[model samples]
Target: MDKLEEITSDGVAVCQPGLRLGQLESEARKKGWELRMYPSTLVKASVGGFLAGGSGGIGSVAHGGLRDFDTVRAFEVVTMEKKPRVVLHEGPAVHEILHAWGTNGILTRIWFALTPAVEWMQLTAAFSTYEEAFQFAESIATGNTWTKRLATVFEWPIPSFFTPIKRLVRADKSLVLIMIAASQADALHAAAIAAGGEVTFTGAFDGPRTQPLLSDYTWNHTTLWAMKADPAYTYLQCGFSLTECREQFRKLRERYGQEILFHIEFMKNGDGVVIPGAIPLVRFSTEERLNDMIAFCRSIGVFVANPHVNYLEDGGRFRPDNIQLLAKQRYDPRGLLNPGKMISFRKQVVTK
Candidate 1:
């Protein structure tokens, strides 16, 4: 809660890691500045958690994730050694603990890159089918005339989970959730109409809202909504390159059918190319079936970032990260902090 630093005119803000992201954002908003990237759970997520956990959320389409290096300018960590020392890592060196799940070091403070704040409006467009919604989301995500903070498509019937805003969603229509610059509303509306969608809802976050914020319905929140409506569900995290999106999407739908509800969030890659990433709300069966589904998705060239596991590597790349390994060795030599999260650290000790 302390260390609320001043936001630079250029949009950089340095503060204590304990500060909530939502509070920081509100402070910066007064100065017309905003964090370049933030997860949807901003109100509850801390600056430290976002970095140490390696999170990506709303602004990732433009700013990438916390691991992007530029997103985080610096990290001040307290080592977990017998003689603990304060270490300040700059630039890419911060990556050592950036997503180490707090296994490598304790983050005490962080410096984040910020951007000019915009009056963002939450808008939802309805389409006749999930396919049209997907195509329309991609177009707006990659469009030049209108910039967006978020673009997510939900398959038909999934919108029913938003019981708070049941009137906004139609039973027969799929939903496209978006957050765009208020100035570009007309352009976005035109694009949606041209793409065979109806702009159903549009308003600011504070503008007479009866339901939760639009972002709370997108991202992993979509999965939460589904789980609320039907407790018999889990979710998967997978990325589909533009080239493989249509084919893989169709194949998965055909294979899982109603058992898997398709939801996709459009994001730009490291190179700023648009791609559709899926978080399929899966009807729970057994662990074996989940593993089989992950394997099947990967076999079809879909990159599955497994969410069912707890280990950092298992949840992500499924292999040891060299940078994280080096950081743990230097900062948490005794491995007293957040044990059992880094698979590589355990293996290193066994080998020794």
Candidate 2:
């Protein structure tokens, strides 16, 4: 909100912090604009980081990922005019100002649209077998069975390891199924159970009423602990329908075998590209699961854009875009203002 207020006031210049809430994006989408935040808006990442480095979190799945949401209106840029070279540009010429690899101009502020916020509710079901749990996960996420939010389901290869808390889950074959509902808990609940799941509602009132899943969202920690085999492990983001996801998912499970621990978080995909972490960050022992996540991602072609893979590798910083951006470092031919990062990138640079 600070960044939003800043840009609106024309004083503050940038943003992107934590997991972006769908309610916020949906609200923005109504006006024909959306912003994809990395690590999330909740963490409050700077928009400069978001624009400079393509990153995303909870709000990505439905918001067309990152670049898709930004349709910049005008630029308050420095043009070459005697001592002050700032130009207000129109049309594709704005490209000279944007994606400049960080040199052509300093992006102080921008004017964009807002989207509608998606109201959501989360649901879960625990089963006794991987097939049962994965089946329901696949089933619910199949045809947009639920609106606004996606079903996040996981299977415990060793259900007994979870114990009484784990026992609440079946025994050796239990599967934990989770889904999100817009408002109809009863209807969504019934649908999940009917499709072969043992359902449970995770959240309960501790204070006053707030919109359910949409109000306070969480979905990543679950995947991290359960999917990331080791604490040192990392993960990546990808887009695939239930069918495509499952096909590749099976291939991953079978090919990697025990070497890789795999799990998936499901989220609704419409216009935005999101990273859906389990509601409310919860940490369970995920060390063993993470070790294989990185390798698994490469196997599947999922791009993991954390600080490691992209940054830190250019000549020294290991960023090539910085090198390209160096040519257009100045809005004016003679460099005056502080220029952007001058380095290189190791990964591929994509244009929108």
Candidate 3:
């Protein structure tokens, strides 16, 4: 099942769902093409798992997310019934199972859209303050002059947890990690310096690389590093309004202080508008305090996709999409797939 079946003339990759994203990427690169977006767990994440559970990661800065219409071209699904039926979903219909957490149907094969590959460079910029690092990341995300894949900011103490890169990171400095097209490395370096940041590290992002790819320090991996350092740390998935992110950042820092370590990933939304998404690590104190912090974030107009919950609706989406519900009814009518994860499934059954 872990096979790269074909790469179409138009740059589409037709592959088995069991293929690891890292493998797919390497194969794509061999053909001078690459996936639009992939999760930070690229080395271990399977195509089927990513389509079922992930939202966005590395390349999201330029391509939005896997859920975006253009990212996935098609899905070959198998129903979970006796004498199961094979179905091919194309275009927007693929969203019916995208991020559905395998509760809709089993994905057998998938067709992913690819783009011409670019040599990317991984680098980090250190700033005197977290705010400056954040501003610099936002500039790279929203600016069109430079083509970028990742733009992440790690607030002071958060960088301390990345022991592998300790040599490049200063104890007192906030950090901005970036993956930009190698062609724009000079431009990005000049911009960082002009914005009062120092380019602390830079290296080739492709080909034979170091043990820890710089990407491992981003997205949810940021939380993983913090947790590895101190198990007391947990995280929250937040989406700050693009227009109000700067103010939201200020408020969050003032309100939580060291209680919550700020980490930001800048990416485009479905509509192609750049937004600041956060996976901030919270110092676990009490259940009550955690809930209170979540409420405080909501009160401030920052969207919290609570990661502490297990239910599908309670996590990122907050509510099940009607399309996903309808598809579930058709593909997994008995609700045998990932039972109990989709709260809406039980509710719909009760209502019926």
Candidate 4:
């Protein structure tokens, strides 16, 4: 409350993580105000940074993506007039600022239309093969029901077949979980069946909700695995669609020759456009292959904007479309915030 009051009073950029969204939302609701919420973690991310960049969250697959939540609201922002401004804008105005990565005017405070919270039904589906696993993903992406949390595909390839196997092994395809929380668990289960998905679990998120039994450590955990038949390896993070997931799997095998470590949390993109289903990627290691791993991911069609951007893949939020665009025009006519960051067109701002 204090932080928010400070921003409302001074009108400066303020960012926070998902766990605190309730605080902001409640505050807005109390004063008949609103806000933009980035739905991930605050461990290493900032408020303006995440939502300002198109991040979603674990609940997106069923509830809708971050941008959906940011669709309506007021923005407390700084202006070029050498003073602050309270912009009561929606649609385009919101987009101008949302996910533009601060190229537009800086957002001191943001308010979003509150979504009705609901009781969630958590579930998962694990398959033996990537083909079977991904088949489930496609169906969920195109489903009509609103009872889904996430749809993921995991892999655990087998050992090198001939000491020189060409294609990656099945063992390389390990455990990937497509997590989802829905209004109706049974409906999601039926959809999973129609989609060729195998139900791994339902509700309770057994054994570490955040996974890895740790709060902060993300990415390939393979750096310090046991060399003696070390069943454990590092992981990598990638944002891809059901369609892109298969191709990416192929690329990982073809490019790096490294197999899937264990888990890939495949969630929904809500509307499945642009960022398309915020997918959670977990590679087991962070060794000397970070650069190569990232390059390989990009070459295969994934948008590698910012590391924090991926947090949205798990359910973080950002502002809407138009607002983000306007912010881009007024504040960063040069599009030089991060150069090739988020905002794509700025010369038109200059042209005007």
The C-alpha RMSD in Å for every predicted model, in order, reads 2.6, 8.6, 2.3, 9.6
lDDT of each: 0.80, 0.42, 0.87, 0.45
Tens-place lDDT per residue, model 1, 26-70, is 888878888777777877888888887746888776666666638
Which ten contiguous residues of candidate 1 have the minimum total lDDT? 203-212
Off by over 4 Å in 4: 1-19, 22-38, 42-49, 62-64, 68-72, 80-89, 100-106, 157-183, 187-200, 204-245, 259-303, 306-352
At residue 1, what lDDT does model 3 achieve? 87
- Cα-lDDT of candidate 4: 0.45
Tens digits of lDDT, candidate 3, 200-267: 89888773244548888899988899999999999999989888877887787798888988899988
Of the two candidates 3 and 4, the one with more favorable TM-score, higher being better, is 3
206-313 in candidate 2: lDDT tens per residue? 111332331122234443444344453333344434445556656766755644334445544434323322221112335444435545654675533332233223
- In order of appearance, the predictions have TM-scores of 0.94, 0.56, 0.95, 0.55
Could you say which candidate leads in lDDT? 3
Q: Can you tell me which runs of candidate 1 are displaced by over 4 Å?
A: 206-212, 317-321, 347-352
Report clashes for each candidate as comma-separated counts. 0, 88, 0, 82
142-239: candidate 4 lDDT, tens digit per residue: 46555344444444432221122222223443322333434566876786666555565565432123332111111222122212234344333456
Candidate 3 has which clashing residue pairs, if any? none
Model 2 TM-score (2 dp)? 0.56
